[model samples]
Target: MIAKLLSATALACLATISSTASAQSGSGQKAPTANPAQPQSQPNPPSSKPEQQPTSKQPTADRSKLIEEAVTAVRETRNAVRAIDQNKPADAISALERATGKLEIVLARTPDLALAPIDDAVITYDVIGTVQDVERIRAAAKAAFDRGRMQEARRLMDGLASETVLSVTNMPLGTYPAALKEAAALLHQGKPQDAKRVLETALNTFVVTRTIMPLPLARAQSAIEEGRTLMEKSNRTDAESVRLGSLLARARDQLRLGQALGYATEKEMSDLVRAVEDMERRTSGKQQARGMVEPTRPMFDAANKASQPPKSN
Candidate 1:
């Protein structure tokens, strides 16, 4: 069976970009280098203080091992398909039996698992543009789409986001075992063609999911965290205050960007802005705004989590 892969670039083109005009009043033009196809930065842990160009970490070792353990079954399944193509019914059934047995071994160890993760990919749409730019592109795309200019619409939408996409592929446990049994039954009934179809269909039954994370929100979160660290520095000076203000200001800008890009509502963003302002006031002349940022953190965390949509292409 051929692998179904969603490379970073492929994911962006296939997935619909979330865009709507919600530019905040007096929003400054802070275009981030004008390229929407840059690689994503790695997300830092909550306690991390340094600047990080967030990288999507590889699937954890446990998941990698799990998928590796399931490969024998996948390979045997492929062998069964090959046997069917070669018209060797006996070989095909033997391959399938071996495949099924291997799958059983894998499942027996992890009975509670539903879908076994097979593969994953990361997509970064690092668009560098202001809110107005997004609005203009979105409007144009919508107009073109309405007029049935699909190509034009797609072109307009090609680089229309500032976010990261995570795609996971999983093998369905509930239906796959049953499917294998059914295919085996069909083969025993002298229906090699039907059994082959079943096998092929089952091979392609892997499920995929995508989670969209707004980079703007992530940036906002990062900015606040960095600012928090700055506040903890000994004897905060005037220069430190200026940097703190800039960090707060950047967080506000990113929040506005997130709202404009449809990751969050205007009301939600406005409330967040006020929250940032409150933090700003607390840190104006103080050497410790550490606790100040903490109060607004949960709100930022909640908003960022809400902005992510569990969608797929």
Candidate 2:
């Protein structure tokens, strides 16, 4: 009876043990999952960090290429000017228009050129004078045509065509500092013409005021007008005549300088010359001439035109 009791107790203990083992196995099959928001723990090697990519260089501008293109355009313009001078108006006009288009493209792309080292003053003056000359040529052409001067009108038109090209001839090179450096080298090499061409290109790169005369010419004109007004308004005397003579002499000097610099147009210079001649007659004679205003009026008109800024087209 004691042996039977011992066997029954052992079976009960075995059954409890088996039930516990089954529960543990079932729980083991259902593994714990990682939270979606949390990062899975990673095993990293000792002293190891993330790898880095190499830095890339930024793209640089090709200023030399830009300057070369500009120089080529200027040479084309110079050639076009020569064509115009040869009296091929139609061909010259077409060439000039093309040259201008090329220059405008260069100018539009390069804003740094304005601050670049160059002769901005002389270049600006040259361009403006050329532009103004072109306008005057157009007017002169019409006037010549009206007065039955066909040859004169044709010549004026051709001149206008040439001026159009000349106005923009050296523009691109003028704006680039490197071009000036190259020009300096050419000068040192004794290629003055080549150096001159380079400088011209640099000067022609930008346009400024087209109507305002160069400072010296403008000042001289003012002096002449002031003297004329004083002569006409005040009492005529030897001292007054001498004063007027001094003023005329000063004006002549200025005009001469302007001519030397190729600033004033032939017609403009002629008008000034006429005024000076009339003033000389007045200053040298006993009394102021009755027809002095006639010659001087044209001179004043020319001066006035030079002083005023060009109207926008």
Candidate 3:
């Protein structure tokens, strides 16, 4: 009976070992199946990468189109001014309106276009011809100003000033006198601030110095006088008055510019003094002439009678 029991125990142990091995094999197979599902979870294919989207590039071509539009608008405006000079008022007005509209579009699209080239072209083309195209721009600005279009007037004046400066840039020193004359008009029109700014900018050119012996000093004095006159005529609260203050500040700036350019020489200073004296003499002469024109016969007779009677008494 004991041997039979032992044999039975050994058979049971063998059965248990077989069952454990089968369980181990089943688990190993499930692991591979789990790995297959993991690949499904990684649904993103190599073809579906984030970089596959189209890249947004710079709109260089678009910018070029805007610049072309701006250039065309400037040219059209210039042509319109020429028509105005030929006494074609209607045609000129119509063309100018169209040009203004085109420029508006360009400005709306791209406001920061470098206008130096356009400005240069406008002045060069107008000043050399009988067109007086630049004058038309000034007229437009004046009309705008009269109509309470302050911003519009400012824009037009700025454009005009820029163009004038550009035209004189390449000219010899002799051209500054004429340029200053043009600038003076702008100043007289209550745009003294603009005049000062333009003169300051034009003085940057070496040609201006090459032509005038004491170029920097002369410019500084002129700027200072312009500022002083404008300030005297201005009301402190008005925009134009404020601009006059700016002109005065710019005059001081021109003095500094003269110093920087080495144009502040003894001769220049002497010339400045002489100019001041001449101006004073002219002013005094005019005052004297006005006094002489006064109607003072009655007062003179009264004074003469009083003196004669006092002597007789």
Candidate 4:
């Protein structure tokens, strides 16, 4: 048999978001480093075409961490790939057997599973700035996207959002087990070339999904809380009132940023902004601002809550 080279491209580590710091420099704030992959929403990875980039990219450190709790089938798949790379057919067959055995255990528990989850990690990216900054970046990103400059578009929009993104990878239960079994049989038939191709196909059948939590909305809520704390104080000093005004402005700014980033509907953000600015106007004269930020809380709360975490099958 002719020695065939197996093509297995493991996911490359997500590129670090270096430009966000420069983007946020105007606000003197660093975008959340909690490790978000991209500021944009992404679809699940396609089981048929694994060559395309995933909607969510994991930071290198987080990828290393996810490997710590590796699922048995996934790890075995990696082992099988490695064995193929080293031209060790026997080892590859052994790894596939172990993988199938694990799947048997899993399928026995959940027979109707569609896609079995392998692992997930949270990736966060935050771009902290006032409304003007968001507008500037949004325009640039739109132009870049229109020009079909995806990398440029992604970079420009990266700092326009403040979000916590969760990326998950799963194996398609419908076909993966069969592929493993077929690869094993191919090996037994003394066709390592064919077996290697089957294994590669199996690896690419994994799908990925991303869930996003808006950090800007949360920041707005935080600002409102801080302002409310001051309002709760009796005999508030003029300086405190001025500080309250600043906080209200920050809250309004965050709301506007959130709106630009499409975290909330225009109407929803508009209503909140109108209310916040109205309160802000009252606080302008250094007078005690009277209002409960609690009413405004529900909208932000609802938006954040809507971004449910990824569920493993």
Candidate 5:
């Protein structure tokens, strides 16, 4: 009876162990392999998210430095186009594309860069005689596209776009003196209303013309034109005339400041100073100067011509 009990207990314990192993295996968990040469499988590493790299971004002040670099690159590309070897059109196109890339980086960030001054004057690309080169490259690019040279065509297109933008952005400054001269001529002819309109328009617009105007001279010209406009408008009523006198006084003050800064000629300084004083007297309900318009015309002509900077060779 004791032997029979020990056998039954051993059988029950073995059955429980078998049942547990079978359940674990049925649940998709592999039991350890009994073969000595086989190794156990490892579960996949905890599925971690990817690590991102840091970006290299610079400060805002260095943006101007980048603009200068882009300008230099554009200049180089323009120069390269002048001597492009026909057999190696790819080489010239590549250089131009690189320059375009540099420009694009800046343009994307600052579209108003056209209005930004590089060195006291608007940043000028001044691509000397590049229009013909651009046309030639465009023709080549079209031909390449026709021949299924897609890469070359794409490069040429990029270069053309960049060159076109640079050329457009290099617009010359307005001839403020010329406009002032026109205003003076009108005033001399007793057309003060027309003269005033001209002066006001010039002050309000980016008047692009074929004249080289220095920045300081341009500012001085605006002040003088404004003063002259105010003086002309003063002829209506006593209140209006008094207002004009006060404004002209301030305008004369600005001209004096410009003169001290060497922006105006000595002759201009004297003439405008005298004109403002005469305007003050006339507008103050006192004796008006005789032949005011005719006397001031020559002074304006001299000042206008003096304000014009010599054209670049």
Candidate 6:
């Protein structure tokens, strides 16, 4: 009975030992599988910070190119003026068109260019002048009494005249409108040659008003009208005796106009004075040439004549 009991105890011990070994092997296999899942939960290494990008700026080079193009256009316009003076109308027109194209480009690239305002004014003046010249030529080419051409010419003249009047009238309160009105009236009356003369005088008056300090441009217009009346009377066949008188009257009117312009405003009178001087100088030269006087003598006489007092109206 004691031996059987001891054998039973040994068998029990072996069974327990076998069970413990099996449990240890299962735990070892489960640990590896659990480790892989733990790896998924492990936080990823911190990501590196993203780099920044750069920004763009305005192009100075583009601005310079735009300015250069504008300057080139101005030069081309001057060339066109020269061509017009030489009576090459077709060439002048072509050059002016090219200049206009370049100016358009300049405006597109740099609308706020500093010289844009002055350029616009110049363009308006030049284009109007050209339009007037072309219309005058077309009218002259038309058959006499061709109502259609005459009407077309008159229409164009009216538009230019209205524009001129409006330009002057829109100026500051002190600016004169009389000269502009007179020029418009002359153009409307189908007197383009007379209108051109009036317009020239008006331009001078405008310049003078900006410079001198007393006489208004309206006064100059009145003087020009008086001169025109005298000129018309001198055209009569029986007016030979009064031709010299008429010429003298016209000279006096111009002198009065110049004097008025000389003292019109309160700005810089130098420009006005220079313009008046140039006109007087040119008129004097023409007169001397007509009298068959020596070039030097006529020039001197002109200078002296311009300095003398003007005759009464």
Q: Which of the two, 1 or 5, has more lDDT?
A: 1
Q: Which sequence of candidate numbers ranks them by TM-score, best first?
A: 1, 4, 5, 2, 6, 3
lDDT of 6 by residue, 51-85 (tens): 11111111434444544554455455556546545
In order, the Cα lDDT scores of the candidates are 0.65, 0.42, 0.33, 0.61, 0.40, 0.31
lDDT of 5 by residue, 115-167 (tens): 31222111211111133444456577789999999988877554221100000
- True lDDT of residue 221, candidate 3: 43
Q: What TM-score does prediction 6 earn? A: 0.21
Higher-lDDT candidate among 2 and 3? Answer: 2
Model 4 vs. true fold: TM: 0.61
Q: Write the per-residue lDDT of candidate 4 for residues 1-313, one digit (tens) a residue.
A: 1111111122223213211110100022534331222333323221111112332234545434333323678789779878978889899999999988888766765565555546555444556554555666777778989999989888766555556554456677788889999999988998888988998988887877654556667667778887887866667788898788788878887777778777756777788789888777765655455566767766654555443342346
Candidate 4, residue 14: Cα displacement in angstroms equals 19
Q: Which regions of candidate 2 deviate over 4 angstroms? A: 1-212, 233-235, 290-313
Per lDDT, the best of the predicted structures is 1
Q: Could you tell which candidate, 2 or 6, scores higher by TM-score?
A: 2
Error of 3 at 201 (Å): 15
Top candidate when judged by TM-score against the true structure: 1
Write down the lDDT that model 4 would get: 0.61
**Candidate 3 residue-wise lDDT, 1-313, digit = tens:** 0011112222222222221111100000122110111101111111101111111111545434543444454455445445544655455445545645655665466443322112111011001111134445557778999999998877765422100101101222233333444444554465544544544554453221001112223333444445445433423445555554454444444333333222334344344334333333433312211231122223222221221111111
* Clashing residue pairs found in predicted model 2: 170-201, 171-204, 171-205, 173-202, 174-201, 174-202, 174-203
Decoy 3 TM-score against native: 0.21
**lDDT value, residue 206 of candidate 1:** 85
List where candidate 3 sits over 4 angstroms from the true fold.
1-58, 111-313
Model 1 TM-score, all chains together: 0.75
Q: What lDDT score is found at residue 87 in candidate 3?
A: 50
